[model samples]
Target: MASSKPKPDPLSIQRGDYARTLAGPLLLGLGRMVSIPLQHWLLTAHPLSHFGIPRPPSDGVLELPLVGAQPQLSTIFLGMTATLILKQNAWIWGYCAERITVPFAFFGVVVPAMYECLSALVFSYASSNPLWRKEFLYVGAAVHFFAAAVELGSELARARFKGRIENRGRLYKGGAWGLVRHPNYAANVVYGAAYGFAAGGPVYALFTGAFYWSNLTGNATPAKENYLAERYPEEWEQYKKDVPWKMFLGIF
Candidate 1:
């Protein structure tokens, strides 16, 4: 008889896991360093004006005067970078599995760096032009911050629950998980939408939100559920009964 292949260990450190962890902070940090100056230039210098990019008249719907907007934008970027770094560290140390491949690590680094660059560009343009009311910016920023908190908190809560000796091989259905099966994924969608809204307006927010929602629901969430079902068949079924919602509470 042929020997059975070894089962994968979630706790086992994989070849690229450490590199992925390191790359996340490095790329995000670099992006933050670049974004601040880039945004400042876009907001103050109007460097692209010669290219015929016209600025729209400010209608004062949460219109942040240019002077105030620069400082606020800087603060937003700073907060976002800090939050991302913290979240990255939390996932690596607390929740990440051996499934983090080198390609995935590379993807993670490139995407976040690109997002930071794009955000700096778009937000600067929107701030100058005053698209879709200014109040939405404040609202979006607030929602983004809130979603970040929830994401980080939920991840930490689950990590802590998993760390207990008695809880080995058990499922965590407490904290934010009690509210939704995948609170981190839910928060991810919210934050993406909120960030897009803060950057460009409602249309951008809708696009970004839909993107995250589809990616999570169609891919990440289902894969995770499948893994959990295989690993903890009894617990997962009961947990599903207890918490019917996957991401959102009332919808989905």
Candidate 2:
């Protein structure tokens, strides 16, 4: 018999996802203690969440996949279909940006939005504790859904006026842009943290917050800055003064 190729070391296999490797099991064991109490404390602080706690999101937004679809879909069946299609459309267009929208509209506007949506799902599902139906599964789903909605909404806001305006590809300063420099990105961080909550360990949230935020901000911000300078130089410079939140870290 031919000799079998050597198996990859488990450690090496997981090196890229260090949080899942070194810290996942530990978080799994501690997810309940960390997620439940913190959730209670945080949600109870909000009148709406506290009131809704007993009823269990009658909208069943958690079960829904679009995660970001407007609750306005009205009918139950149509709503679900719309959400899935919308999300899938975003995934397809964003993924295929390389082929469409020249000079800038495609990649910068789409890729970051799509990556975060995927991350939301990953974070939500990965952190979820199958045993805790509501806490991990349902809750995790809700968090990611909200996360996707926020980013998509931001992207939509950014792209909406683009086609109508003379300079469709120009950097903007309105809607979410009105809220902060990167309100969408800031929301991504929040959703990512929520994914960690579902994952069960506060540690997961910390690692994601610290590492991913830093890297994405560094990469995207510079590119965006460059794009703004190249496309809307003066307006882009002023856009900074009006909205200075970096990852909504402080300026949300």
Candidate 3:
């Protein structure tokens, strides 16, 4: 009887990703925390609050309390995402740079703008109304952080495989990469939904989730796959055969 190939241990490898420099991840995490909040404040409270002027009664403004359970919950939820971004930066900057490239400027410019606009609007609409129950907030935060964890795992896996193979140019399939062709993208979509819920409520989650889906499927995934296919034809084809879904499990 032939023995089956041993599965790679997900936690067994380290490529000195953190030893290089933590500045990048720390900055990124800080940026992540400020990104949406700055947008939210600018569109809602900043003009008045910054200038010490009384906020005029307006139906279109976000009126989240200065301190409350809802705002606190939002902060905690968003904070976890920011923390994960910092934690995962080592894997992303270390491993992803080898095989990944900015396929288009749209992702760098347009998508984030869209997300900010959507989030700002959601906050404006939902901040006053207590649309999120405590239970729902707890569940949403768990899902968000879980997806962030998955993203971190995927990056670590890629870095580990790259280290093991000693091939800087080929696709690495050691850790979470084996579970899905694009685990990062899958996790992003899941986290987006969680962010949406935290930002606004269920309605916001729907909008954010749809945006992530479109961004991943319509723009990012195809471009990445095409580049990989061109760069590593035989390996890419074999990879597709082994891992069929572009993102997530049998869903995509």
lDDT of model 2, residue 150:
78
Candidate 2: segments with Cα more than 4 A from true spot: 1-137, 167-169, 249-252
Preferred candidate (TM-score higher): 1 or 3: 1
Over all chains combined, what TM-score does candidate 1 have? Answer: 0.75
Q: How does residue 84 of candidate 1 score in lDDT? A: 62
lDDT of 2 at 155: 75
Q: What is the number of backbone collisions in each predicted candidate, taken in the order shown?
A: 1, 3, 0
Which tens-of-lDDT digit does each residue in 13-35 have in candidate 3? 21212343344334443344455
lDDT of 3: 0.61
Q: lDDT tens string, model 2, 98-200?
A: 2222213233334434433333333333313233233443454466577768778787766665646685556657777776777666766766565554443
The digit string of per-residue lDDT tens for model 1 on 1-252 reads 999946544322242233444554444344344544554555556555676764422433233556444255445644565566566656655666444544455556566657665765666566455465566767888898899889988887887887799998898888888888999999999998987887778887887788788888997787788778978999899999999999999997
TM-score of 2: 0.49
TM per prediction: 0.75, 0.49, 0.65
Residue 158 shift from truth in candidate 1, angstroms: 0.9
Ranking by TM-score: 1, 3, 2
